[model samples]
Target: MNITEVRVKLTEAKKNRLQAFCSITIDNDFVVRDLKIIEGYKGAFVAMPSRKLADKCPKCNSKNHLRSRFCNDCGAKLNDKRALGESGDESKGKFKLYADTAHPINSKCRDEIEQKVLAAYKEESEKAKQPGYKPPAMEVPDLDFDEDNTNS
Candidate 1:
């Protein structure tokens, strides 16, 4: 899929590892948002949007985060180890805390995404250096809000 557009929001913090947040449009058809531009140990890299992994509480059957010590609803101690694996060993819970919402299937696709995202991030970073430059707002417009105070 061709990366048609990429918009980046550079982070204000200098020492932060999270450099920027980006949204990419693919072929003008599909749009993926919340992709992160992180400053890694080696260099900057693109991280796909991900959601925190959750496990169901055995007592109340309530969904709780993987790292949650106790269930939010029931207050029962979470069995994270069991969720990680069949084995009861707590030390063996090496499961990932988050899962990607959208990701490339192959290395080639990943490389292409990385290249485009990083390039856009670099461009945005340079733009930030310009005097009186402001990052573009990523928020959606409120459709329900009236321009004039109708209720008043």
Candidate 2:
């Protein structure tokens, strides 16, 4: 898939690992939002959008994040080892508490996305150092059709 456009919004907190938020337009048709530019040990990398993994509390039947020590609703003690089993290979530090909402199926696609996103992030960062730089708007325009405004 061709990356038609990439937009980056730099974060204010310089100390944080999260450097920026980005969105990409694929083939000028599909849009994916909330991709992150994170400062890893090696360098900056793009992280796909993901959501916290959660499971229901046995006691209260309330949903709780996999890493949660206690249930949000019932406050019952949760099994800390629960996520360890669900996520594969904790010994290798591959334990996951979040699941990617969208991701590339292969390494080539992933590399393409990462390269494009990081380049945009670097460009945005340089722009921020300019005299009067404004962050790019990350909002996607509404595409919904209104029946009243439609032409017959």
Candidate 1 — which residues are off by over 4 angstroms? 80-84, 87-94, 140-152
- TM-score per prediction, in order, is 0.82, 0.86
RMSD of model 2, in Å? Answer: 10.7
Each prediction's RMSD to truth: 10.5, 10.7
lDDT of 1 by residue, 47-107 (tens): 8877777878888899997778899998998765655666656587345667788989899
Looking at model 2, residue 94 earns an lDDT score of: 47
Q: 12-113 in candidate 2: lDDT tens per residue?
A: 778877778789999999999977777777888887877777899999999998878999998999988887785545686546677788989999999999
Candidate 2 ranges beyond 4 A from true positions: 86-92, 139-152
Error of 1 at 123 (Å): 1.0
